[model samples]
Target: MSISIIRLGIDFGLVVLIWMIQLIVYPSFLHYTTTNLAGWHRKYTPLIGYIVGPLMLGQLGIAIYQVSTDFTFYHSLSILIIAAIWIITFLQFVPIHNNISKGRVSESMLMSLVRKNWSRTILWTLIFLSSAVQFF
Candidate 1:
């Protein structure tokens, strides 16, 4: 009903969608048999790249800008957590994704990678939730 509730709902929805893609769709598509992998990959990669990725980045940018202007406890903490998550994702997650694509990946490796990067995902989600509170 309120603006804060609407923003919270949107933020939660975005995070949930991303999590579903990373945790379910990606692994399913990767482990799919036949032409399913290619089909799903072609369909989803563009959506993630062109739409979801940019929107998430824009939200992060806004968070950063807001942090710069605010400089309070929660704002600083949220920015740091978000930045850490982004940095870890690019440095750690991307390599794992590349390895899997190159046929050099194992299930254990993928699982381990996900486990290691879980903190990043969790932290980013927290940052999103905390920042969304500012909308209220």
Candidate 2:
């Protein structure tokens, strides 16, 4: 199969995943009590990581390969956006998830999670759209 097709599939998976996270998963945290949320978060993070980790790695690996092989505008932009998403995930979301798992969650924090996640949602959507345009 073509690399562009593979890249589009990965990007599509991520865009769907991010929308689910943004619209459904994160917001649902607000409904739980602090203790329940913490307990659930502990389990949820690892479970979700299983799905997220491979997709992210595939996306990143494909992005790197595309850029290194072709060095086109689309590949370069895709890699830069992927890099930003990685930075945001580690630098911003990881600490928040850690705190939540440790029972340090507050309403504000939950709200912040939903709020901050918009950036990722938009970025992933853009990646998918760009991939689609390139593929089609």
Pairs with steric clashes in candidate 1? none
For model 2 the local lDDT of residue 118 reads 97
Q: After superposition, how far is residue 113 of candidate 2 from its true place, in Å?
A: 0.5
How well does model 1 score by local distance difference test? 0.63
lDDT of 2 by residue, 66-106 (tens): 99999999899999999999999999999999999999989
- Note the clash tally of each candidate: 0, 0
Task: Give per-residue CA lDDT, model 1, range 1-136, as digits (tens).
Answer: 7533543564576577667765875556437643444455456555666765765676576567667776789867866776786788789877766655455655677567657756755775786678577767
- lDDT of all predictions: 0.63, 0.95
TM-score of 1: 0.72
Which regions of candidate 2 fall more than 4 Å away from where they truly are?
Answer: none
Clashing pairs in 2: none
Local lDDT at 122 for model 1: 76
